[model samples]
Target chain A: MNLGLDRNTIYPATHMWRRFSYFFFAIFFCFAIAANLLAQDWIKSGTGLGVERIRIAVPEFKAANQDPRNSELLRTFNDTLWNDLTNAGIFEMVSKSFYPLGQIGAPSDVKFDTWGQTPVNAAMLVFGNLGASGNNVVVQGWLEDVKNPNSPPVLAKQYTDNATTQQARVIAHKFADEIIFRLGGGINGIAETQIYYVSTRSGHKEIWAMDYDGANQHPVTTLGTISLSPHVSPDGSRLAFSSFNGSAWEIRMFSFDLNRMVSFPRYGRTNLSPSWAPDGTRLAFSSSRSGTPEIYAVDQSGGNLHRLTNSGTTNVSPTWNRKTGSEIAWVSRHGDLPKIFTMSADGTNVQQLTDQGYAVSPSWSPNGQFLVFSWMRHYGPGAPGSQDIYLMDVTNKQWVQLTHDGGRNDFPCWSPDNRHIVFQSNRSGSLQIWSMLADGSNQKQLTTSGTNSEPDWSWK
Target chain B: MKQSQSRWIALVFALGAILFLGACHKKAAPAPPPPPPPPPTPTATLTANPETIDKGQSTTLTWQTSNATDISIEGVGAVQPNGTQQVTPTESTTYTLTAKGAGGTQTATARVTVNAPPPPPPPPPPSLTEEQLFAQNVKDVYFDYDKSDVRADQQSLVQADAAFLQQHPNMSVTIEGHCDERGSTEYNLALGDNRASAVKNALVAAGVPADRVKTVSFGKEKPFCTESNEACWQQNRRGHFVLNK
Candidate 1:
């Protein structure tokens, strides 16, 4: 029997290397399946469907050398990783006081009984070590099931970058994402994502960007004019916003590829609130080119203009359901006050989604399952309620308030994972960008110095 | 008797000479030359630099005076005795400079030619385009809170605006809808649009062409007043007119 084998010409080293790689791949595949199964069961429990939130203990990373940069970089890395996991909404972190009083850095140093037993009582254990050698920083991290210590670690990773504080935070985010993927029901984490928002820190409302956790806040536009409603493109290469170009408010685009403003055709009227389709080939905005502020759509290159709403009343703020890219949600004032409405992308099958009060800034979830918008349920001169962000199920029309009495919260955008939301609120005396889990827990203020509003989270 | 006659002649001759001398003294004394004619009547001459210019351009008006205490130009208020000023007049204008002194006032004039564009030009030196005149004369009609209809008190203003548009038959205008900063950005935009539309409709009903009246909404983004008060808000919520040239 010929099995396409050349046994006589096979080299011993090559044969051994091929066999070793095959075994390695087989083990890797098996471990991946095992880890996925474990995470699936844990997610069910974490969601209150089975048991409870996973108890994870993260000990401070050990320092490998006495370099002066090691302590600072290690602190940044540890803090970032801890905050990422804490904000994940699924973990019950064990406090540092409960940690065993000894160094827990390498896999060989892990004591299963110490972490798995009572008093420490962690279901999962995260440990790592960081060091800086000359200009480079190196880190190694692992996630192990303390409950099943005999099994292999669910995650093991190493990262190397320039010995800088920012890179340290980045490496921490990457490691946290890996752990989240292995234990958060196979969904990718959003720790590394960026958010774009309008900030008044520069004396003008210009587009500003920051890391998901609100670090590295920087301005993206220096237009020195009043710019609002910043919506980043789905591909994360362009930012579309409404800018007052001295005479009129027009839709403007800033290209990240060129690091400057790009040319877009002015629609000859008040054009505002540009939203991108999921495919990044089209945009929907509100324009008064047709004598009324109606919802309009245009191509990415500013061609193929089409009108979507003919309601002679006030129709504006068109947002696309990014998952399907077939439906859009907007605000209309056919009656006394504005209400939210949704319609097909081709301008047919219009449906009213909101029945009462003032609803505006409807941002659809990435899954196409819910719309998160700012609403004043009892709106009037002396109404009892304030404007707050609310999330609603598209299929059932049921809703839940995500912000309560926290001043006025508006312009909520969903993260790519659909587990987090970034919004603007005036709870801290000024409008600032904030982030929270989908259930409204872990609300963290992302911007504090400037009046920031209209956050848009990046797609990736 | 000859001596007596010669003496008599000499006496006559002396008397005539004395009379002649008196006349010469009265004429040749010069009467102080009439006190130099009172500071030369305070003369002043005004001249324009680059006397002819296109409309919207500026020119220097220079003046010179011999002796004056108070100097002023018409429509320009007070000025120095002899100085130059850069003036930008929307239309062709003749500037008159007056100099007042103890001696009676004196006046001089300079013409600044604001030339109109050529080819079928309107036949007036102090002419402004229909659009420019409309911007200066048209009135903005106001609205109530969350209401788009032209208010009863604002009807006269709307009529006035319509009357201006009617007089300028060749002009086109854009009415901007604005709102106070008391509502959401999107809703205010719609509200502003309604306000603009209501004013446009009122103008059209008053006999202005609908095609010549365009509308746009600035929402609450551009406020006529920035203070947080009722008076400011009332000023903000109106149909502002812009010339479409």
Candidate 2:
């Protein structure tokens, strides 16, 4: 290992004492280089390019005790953990059939050779054990680098909660989020995030919320009025929406922590589509209190009302850039067809991002780079196009259609992680909420049995 | 000698009397014009917090009067000498707050520009009175797909409706804007608002009152026809008029 050095120049004119010292220095330098190589975070750097994907395997956790409840809890945990990892979008999941036989509950039972070989070929492996300890279910999970036997495990986590199926799922989500944060390059996993949307299942259009994976579907607002546009605050404490207050449309606020409607001032007239600023201190909504529907910004307490658009057109559906809160994208009806526009938060430097189409429901991406909206490019009667969701680069106005021929897909909202999008579609015979990858893959239906629309993913 | 001295004295006395009268005349000429005693002039001010408002919306009219005993707002009648009142003016009006005092009469005006509601459409053939006539004359104004502006072809319909509304001055109609099942719920609600407002404004321009022509947007929630077709959708996108008794 010459290391590009001149060996003759170093060996000549050196006594035995100097030669020994030079050898020792060289050995120390080699060890330093090796240590640096081990310390490098390849996953974090590679994830930015989105080019590399780690092949990982997650085996079902073994039940430490034979209690009847253990199997049920373990079943829930295994299912939740697998679903969370599959939705992570950064790993190539190895099939369980290819995993080596026998339950590996402890570190001594793991055989790195079997997992790193062909067929399994998993660079990383996740295994865990679940056991009941007197009214609590405890889970111990590990992520081992199967390819590098000498390297330490990527993550080792322990979580304990009530001995219930729900708690099992909770523990699984926590463990999977830890794995995602370590291997998916430091971005917090959205598995624990909730999505707030409107559902008519309860006999009225009220605000309903569900887990990010569509579990525990429940209603948040029992206002019993027609509520549209549920926008969660950045802090996940309050929800602002437009509801018919008997006489006219008014923007209303609901506190999730309080489980009731909070006092938000009535701006009067037809107010709709309340979108919170990223800081959660203010909100921008459309109000006809000014004669025509125009965008207005107000504090979270419904004060300091500032008019953002005065075009005298029907401006609605305003969404803020969640990362910067500097730009707001909204649907404006200034021209023949409704188009999407972006402007500074103070309502200066107006720029139109859509040329032709009935574009509406513009939601800014969490990273502030793209906007997802619903567009009908070929509008008018007899036009042969369907309303579909699209993702656009806000800087260049370039766009990609996310949903194709999906029956009246609209109201596309980006998840907080910027990795998934939840939107409403009528393709399933009725209006329901659906979610997909940000790049338009892995489309899944999240709601059924009722007409649901206008999903807003919570900001974690 | 006694007679000459007496004559000189008399002449001096006459001259002194003339001087005294001349001085009195000059003083009277320079005196300030007097009409009894000066009285304090009444001061009054009136203002509307929101000077402009929608037809059904309300605004606060704050007023202050000084040196006033009798004060009254023309439309509001007698109010407090200094206070605020919420007024929902159906039409644009200038409220005059007249403050009367012992000194004089003072009037302060606060102009509240209320957005006038749409007027009635053009008259149709003779019909029965009241609800029946309203139903027969006030036609639904249809719109183009995804368009809120009153279409060119639909101009005559709005005109006729406005004329009818103008004839029935006592009648008020609620215009419900409906959209076809095409756009998002929120956007359609806004589109429906535009459609209803467009019709209402047209009627107002055609001589109808805005307060009489209230507007509500149903968005795509309530469809006239549930079929998913062009004909049904065309029927669905309309500014429907309902006679409010």
Candidate 3:
């Protein structure tokens, strides 16, 4: 019997040695490739495209038809406009310190060379004029494309509001939005928005409101009971939230126009986290009417009731797309741990968004493309858990950690523009409301005094 | 040299025979494992003193177990190896004693039943108002952090509550639920109501009617424990029973 290869099929030992060497070379090649990938920079932006923030210059508006009130009103308006641009997270405004020592308040008044110089180097410009009439103030704003001199102005807007400090500031916010919209290629800015958060400064957990920039902080609900999770309707006509009235957690809708709660006491269940539908005709909230906490869809008038999820575990924090109205994102405790999950409106399809650990407080983006939520991975007793906000792409399970070892971040809600996220983090000593760019940059604390949490942005 | 070669060959043949025998022995099946030792015997004793109770009246159950690491009775939770518990069963229930240890589990049985009481000649004059009488026996039930389950220790209190509610069938109750100041106010609202609902269910199971009790959650708005500590938080997580006028 032949124990070796046939003579015609003789193979060289060198061939076998070569094959062994080839296997080793393949392993080394894989290591080299992996090293290259590991050396690449971590992309903090959730989007793959590394887009640069636009460069814009906002010069102080010239005092047109100067009255004694014009000076202060002009100051208020100009300063507000500047802040709106800065907080947008889409623009890098040329600081007033870097200005060319000129007050250009109109498209024709803008000298391109002054703005084109080393300090400003602006590709876009926002110049405006403000003045006072009898009982109202007039404001005219012009946005210019500094890079393309042949093109017409990017935007031109005018406002006539009562001659009050708030009206002046509001006018500035509008002009700033015009510049942002034109630059952002039609995505509206959140300058004129409001953030409703739970602040304990009033000695009770009350619903409070503040401007997007954290000004005009005032209590919205004076229930003297614990009220939380304020969700504004898309048209800004109603505010939906949950209040604990010593009996049960009931979903309460406060009509802004009526300045009182609309009587819809049909629900007598443990209801919480009431979210408004995009059409403003219905609402989605978690209610325990069926023995266990489940997500339910109800008409705003508490009719057409529908149960959306039956996950059996505690379902909570339901947020709608408010863009297409096709999907709803919420946190559910299925198979033991709480994680983000998405389901159809009619409760047909249920898909878990998170694979492991505790993830909750899911806020669906306006574009219906992403979900921002608080997550603590490997959660257990002594499991070294750090709760942080994470952004996830809905189509794929791809995600980027938005907050790395910040002090216990939770309750992230997306802004109306979808470019920013507001979440509560205890990183700055105490729990406070903080906002950051949707890509996880430009994280700025919004509330400084008292314990603040669960911030919900208003509709544009 | 011829003799030496012959001896070497014989020695080699002899060693080869031993090798052949060893290889043949390898084909035989492996040895079987020894049988496990018999489970240790355990003894459990359970008894109800009165062995009967009225619809909402309380009865005492005493239990004793030997060689047991943990012990519990049917419907009641984990208990001491030798201890007594007061139970108020709405119906005739067979109390099963389960004792577990390293050796094995052993069980015993006791029964408590609802039976009609003998008629008395006369009744004493009313001492307290219906509201005052109900309030005298029924008290608030507390809960653990982030949990809404009624602990076994609170079973007696809940039973007394059911008894009072049953005695005054027309009286109504408001179960105001509350939570500690740790979690989100919105989630805490649900947690607080869960506690209230758990208590209401317990009372209903113990012979009290469901419609007589309504539950509300105040979340962390009305905390019994004001300080931000574990002790205070424990005090705050409660379902306070309030009589409705």
- Candidate 3 runs further than 4 Å off: A1-51, A311-313, A335-337, A383-386, A404-406, A426-431, A448-451, B1-145, B152-172, B227-229, B243-245
lDDT of each: 0.80, 0.81, 0.76
Full candidate order by TM-score, most accurate first: 2, 1, 3
Please give each candidate's TM-score. 0.73, 0.74, 0.69
Q: Write the per-residue lDDT of candidate 1 for residues A1-460, one digit (tens) a residue.
A: 2211234423244533343233222222212223321223223212211134568899999998888888899899999999998876657789999999987779899988999877988988999899999889999999988877777788889999999999999999999988777777666788889999989898988999999999999999999988888888988999999988866778999999999999999987678889999999999998877776789999999999999999877787888997899999998885677888999998999988878788888999887767999988887777854788887766556666677745878888999877788988888888898898775656889899978888999998
Across B1-245, the per-residue lDDT of candidate 2 in tens digits comes to 44355445645654564476457546755546776575699999999989998889999999999988878887788888999999998767667787877666687778777765667686763333576777777789999977788999999999999888887788888898999987777778888888889999999999998889888888887899999788999999999998875
Candidate 3 per-residue lDDT over residues B1-245, each given as its tens digit: 54355445645654564466456545643544975675576689999989877877989999889988868775788899999999987667667787766465677878666774557766554434766686677889988755678988888989988888888887889887788875555556666667888899998999888889888777786778788667898889899998887
Model 2 segments more than 4 A misplaced: A1-52, B1-129
> For all the predictions, what are the DockQ values?
0.32, 0.37, 0.19
TM-score of chain B of each: 0.49, 0.47, 0.47
State the displacement of the C-alpha of residue A93, model 3, in Å, after optimal TM-score superposition.
1.7
Q: Give the local distance difference test score of model 1.
A: 0.80
Candidate whose DockQ is highest? 2
Give the lDDT of residue A338 in candidate 1: 81
Candidate 3 recovers a fraction of native contacts equal to 0.28
For model 3, residues A348-443, the per-residue Cα lDDT tens digits are 788988998877888988767678888876676576647888877676666667776457898998898777889999988888999987756678
| Candidate 2 CAPRI classification by DockQ | acceptable
